[model samples]
Target chain A: MTAAPRPAPVAIDDPADPRLAPYTAMRERDLVGRAGRFIVEGEVTLRVMLSARARFGLESVLLAPERLAGLAEALARLPGDVPVYTATKPVMSAITGFPIHRGVLGVGLRGTEAPGAPLPGLPPALAPALVVGLVGLTNHDNVGGLFRNAAAFGADAVLLDAGTCDPLYRKAIRVSAGAALIVPFRQLADADAILAFAARHALEPLALSPGGGETLAALLPPARTLLLLGSEGPGLPPDLMERLRTVRIPMAPEFDSLNVATAGAIALHHLSRSA
Target chain B: MTAAPRPAPVAIDDPADPRLAPYTAMRERDLVGRAGRFIVEGEVTLRVMLSARARFGLESVLLAPERLAGLAEALARLPGDVPVYTATKPVMSAITGFPIHRGVLGVGLRGTEAPGAPLPGLPPALAPALVVGLVGLTNHDNVGGLFRNAAAFGADAVLLDAGTCDPLYRKAIRVSAGAALIVPFRQLADADAILAFAARHALEPLALSPGGGETLAALLPPARTLLLLGSEGPGLPPDLMERLRTVRIPMAPEFDSLNVATAGAIALHHLSRSA
Candidate 1:
């Protein structure tokens, strides 16, 4: 597809092979240090990485021998320069210090940063159709779910406050169904910075709160929308809530609110449909 | 307060005390073997258990001493006969065979089942506003999220095919924000049984598929609606899809579909708003 031949598969039996260093002790290592490199696990996630070669740099790939055949179509799209490593299940498990259930992993460079040029995720640019922002989202799974929704509904980018957890966290990436890699994103300094960026971009910042001026269905979203969602408990800070335009998803009379990610999905879907 | 006292806290020094047996080795035990009993963890979930005492029976509660003050209001609502077990942090961890970070747990009896009574999740009764049915969902977190959305939107009940994971799974209950304890639900034999029950109750069955008859926005749902969601992969079986009305959540071309639970939440919210 890219006029790049499929890379040759290299077999490595030793668990201590230095080529697999980025993947060792995966549970303990964050995998984000050293050139913004990170691990992408599972075949489904790897396919996204393989396809978006311009957005992410392909460092290398490690797969259990049997998985290679299944991944041939995706692997063929890879540039010939990248190395494809293969190992038996036990060796792969020993290297990662966990059971190799998914049997596929890749290392990629986060390529969004172009130094001296304005940052991508926090740019001073024209507004796009949709963007999703997160404030103080500590849970990796929730971060992942939100990204999946943002991408599914065709959000232009995802912005996160420094208080939020890393979207690049391996579990978050896997849980996101790989949307974290495919969808463009940037981390602002804090919640206020997110609002400021939206202001500069002429983007409408809309927060989803349990109590707000209007219902989700009533809002006619503008051309470029910055849909902000907060943590599950102790929601958006009082000061921030006062500053933004707020909307609520009506629920049963005396029930708890929807999970943060689930609410975001409904809101994103509605905005996408309305737009 | 249900004519109940704050249920005096009984200090438990020994981790292996008989009263704490149900919570022992919690990581290994399923906690649903005998008498339909399961463990509810965290202050938020225990509050739901205490509030809906009629739907769930309280066998015993294990708490860390420091958590007692915070739970005073919820504990007061429990029946006077229920024992509130308190242990030091170390003992609590020892009793659970894992770090009891939440420092709160309660054993609840699933009260939906009555002797020879028609199962509540699959009753032959009048149609209600909304119902969610799951087919072949294997993840507990997804199961819990579906229940959370169902309750938030005031769905009448949730029905699970046997292929779906147990909502009573400890993680599911926590993910559900305790909706698993408060919401009415029942497990049926298979996917077909779910469809059959919808038919008998005069509920319109709607399935979510990527390639469906119409977009979600275009659908005019029925008065008594049954929304069905399948696992993330392989979707609802073909025959079931052909037999029922289908709607799709529009996504960007060539992108993967939304997460099953996230998709379900969007559908439930739409149905709730439309109704």
Candidate 2:
């Protein structure tokens, strides 16, 4: 046999190495300033990115030496050649600005495609699909949970309104257990753009509200639907609320609204079942 | 002019003051070693407690002087007389071991009665009701959310399995938006007991599973039902899964599962609609 295949190695002992710039800059919340790429942490999420053939360009995967043992087997399953970087735990922590428990992290380019665009002659079965619009939901975990729900409930796409957090944020990716990598999503400029898209596609916009006009069962329409959800505190903005068909999940008399992500999942499940 | 009836007042500045023991001990997660009474933070949750007529033996309602003004007005609508403590923000923070963002907090007794007992011979129409069972879920937020969903979806009561987290944990109370107080709940010593209770009452045990045997819509019975939910990672224990009637919410092909609380909400909503 030819000499054992050489492992793709890039030793990074210095946390300040210029080659590790992309990884270092992600430590700040203001990651938008450093690069347009999204950070996907943990081995599971990185594995999904490699398998999905998603458009996010891989920069490099960094991990502690021990993590590389497990990652090597996972990498063997992927088709493309990508750079792998290994560092000591201390150096990895210093570069990432935090101790990464998952041992593996990958920096991938953020997809720039606009959400809701026709997928080059989309199939009829995929048409008339259920889509979710997130508004002012800033929590990374909530955003991740929503994506997970959307995927589980058969939502075709997820659209983020201006105020929502980045779905590609590291915490979101980790929280989603990499489901975020498989789901297609894009950010809309504003709520009006979301409504216009819904109107254009003949998708009835159903705003989920605690004080909604009708129970979800009564308000569901037999057409392509868009479920609109708002932030935890100041629910769907008044303007957005006015534009969509309001549907409520009739709750017990005394309880307040469900968590935003939970409400979305419930609505998506109902809508998909009805569809 | 006769002075308006003054609210009960309690003054204590020292963090070690005996009168403020409950409030002080709550700073630690143990909630003063009672492990039952959860701390409810913020004016909103407190307002929920006051309105639900929850049997809260209020040790004290601590608030900053400014925050106290509005709460004073809201408290007027409450049915029982409860002491309202006023303190400086720093003083309150020092006693509670955390910043009181809502500038309000309450020390309330956790309900000890098992939720399974029939509600004092209520009418038949009201008697037959859907209830939620918290099995292995240990997250405080998840427990609170389950209660919130139960209350919202018109569940009769919430039953917590022995392994589940305490619903009265301050975090759970906060996450539930105080729904924890209004929705009646009972903690069981074992899940088997809950299963037996459901069996005796003719309540079918509908276990939620990501890869469940039937859709939630099909699993719901025409009579009283108990929706059983497992924790996030290692879903319903293997033994528990074997015993209950398994059901799943239909999800997108590539997605895994909805968050446990989200799944519960969807199930509750579906069952409520069918009812």
User: Top model by DockQ, which number?
Assistant: 1
What lDDT does the true structure give each of the candidates? 0.83, 0.75
User: How well does candidate 2 match the true structure in TM-score terms?
Assistant: 0.87
| Residues A69-164 of candidate 2: C-alpha lDDT, one tens digit per residue | 777766665444567888888898888788866668777876455554663211244356687888889898889988888778667778788899
Using lDDT, give the best candidate's number.
Answer: 1
Off by over 4 Å in 2: A1-11, A25-27, A30-33, A53-55, A77-81, A114-126, A219-221, A239-243, B1-4, B7-12, B25-27, B77-82, B111-126
Candidate 1 lDDT over B93-145, as tens digits, reads: 99888887888899887655564465444435554468889999998988998
lDDT tens per residue, model 1, A1-275: 44756657999999999998987988777644444778889987898888852268678999999998899988887878889999988999999899998789988876656654544443345544688889999999899988888878888788899989888788898888888887888888899998887877778999998977789988887778889889988788889889889989999876857878888988988888755
Model 2 chain A poorest ten-residue lDDT run: A119-128
Residues B156-263 of candidate 2: C-alpha lDDT, one tens digit per residue: 778787899877778787777777777767777778988886776677788888867887766646577888898988988888887667998777666666678888
Give lDDT for model 1. Answer: 0.83
Clashing pairs in 1: none
